[model samples]
Target: MATAPTASNLPLFYKDLVPLSSVDHADFHARPLDSADFLINQHAVPLTSDEFVSASRHYPIVFSAGDNPVPLALMGLNEGINTFVSEEGKLINPVYVPAYIRRYPFMLARLRPDTDELSLCFDPTSGAIGKFDEGDVLFVDGKPSDAVNNILEFCKNFEEAGQRTGQFVEELQKADLLMDGEVSIQADGYEQPFVYRGFKMVDETKLRELRGDVLRKMMQNGILALIFAHLFSLQLMREIFAEQVKAGKMPAVTVAPTTA
Candidate 1:
């Protein structure tokens, strides 16, 4: 087994990155939920500049399930959360676009929202990142593992539907291109709900630069530091769970409590 990480093993092993804070909680919502719903109602709402700063100041890491707050990771960078702080610490809204989606073939073309202006969208049905528009109907696929499959299917369905309606054009097909980057087979499947620490949001330009830098450093590091940290924290939770099992303090695999 890999040695458990400690303060001494860190920053160096992780390329000098350290978590801003840590949480002692052992609970993780292992059953994957609808990411689209979590992103919209829990994530997109109440993300004002004031709330970001206030929450960040109170805790170096801020987590949310929709609008609910939670804890940070023990180490490394966590998920990318919308931010209200710049590198200089000024309050500003941070727009988020995952590197995979940004570089993915469809996201760059057919998947991109018509407007360059940043907005939040929760769509498990789309393989590409999407921006929300008023009155555009959305469907939720609650099964997490099926999320990506649904997205791929949606694209195929969309193309077929467009053709049936005479909306398909050869020129539009030209716009469909995937980023040269590959999505890891390991990355397949729905992600369970969990805590993220030190998620900072930035503008689209800044996000692009940061993501590029992170991607460049990914192989050098196991995972990007932020994502690595979150993964590490999840592993740590497993460790905690294992220890608890040994002590009979908890069951081997405890399902998350639906309430509180």
Candidate 2:
């Protein structure tokens, strides 16, 4: 599973980022996405902690393997395979799309590395923002239009949710609750169980052994609910695997050579 982009790494689905400006794009209008083809091959998408409750219902919410692990919603068991999305970029299953996907083509990003200030930016290659005659206007009379204001509001909310997500991950790390994750599925007629790895998850064993006060505090603060949501979502892994099989995207089995 792939993690979200860092300062040095390019964000998924974005080829190039440019700050949105009223001056440079007075006549530009942001068009609604016509298709979800961009997500057709994306098996996993980043998730903010605030999205756990909603996203967990449809996709398995697991963490990336690293020191600062971020949450991710798995759409398929294997890389570059998305069973939920169709060839035409439509959803085969009417599932709750992650905010990370909804926020695509537009996001609030830092313009400089030294400062904390953020600017509204969009992916130029997205083809969503353009000088169209009929679409949401970006600017009017040298000022940002209502549409731009709305986008800014959404981006701000996303940023705030991202910060909260970071805090939730920190709490898990502090409690030593995260561990390397693995899932084993034995499909019918298969001699070997398919083992999947390369991700992380909350260690329920450690969680159950937490001290009374820590558990109480976590419960009161709503952290326990998130952990349970993640654990419950893990069951859907088999469902996704089944979907992949039905879609004919399941990887072929490799039988090891047996010595005489």
Identify the candidate with maximal lDDT.
2
lDDT tens string, model 1, 1-260?
00123354421112122111112111111122222322221112221221222333222221222222222221111212213233342323343322222212221122245865321122223322233342222222332234434444554553444343222112112222111111111111325323222222212233245546555754364323333332233433333333333433432222321211
The CA root-mean-square deviation of candidate 1, after full C-alpha superposition on the true structure, stands at 22.2
TM per candidate comes to: 0.20, 0.94
What lDDT is reached at residue 110 by model 2? 92
Model 2 CA lDDT for position 255: 22
Deviation of model 1 at 249, angstroms: 1.2
TM-score of 2: 0.94
How well is each residue in 147-242 modelled by candidate 2, as lDDT tens digits?
A: 889889988999999999999999999999999888889988788888877789999999999999999999999999999999999999999999
Local distance difference test values of all predictions, in order: 0.27, 0.86
Candidate 2 stretches greater than 4 Å from native: 4-8, 253-260
Model 1 misplacement above 4 A: 1-64, 73-224, 251-254
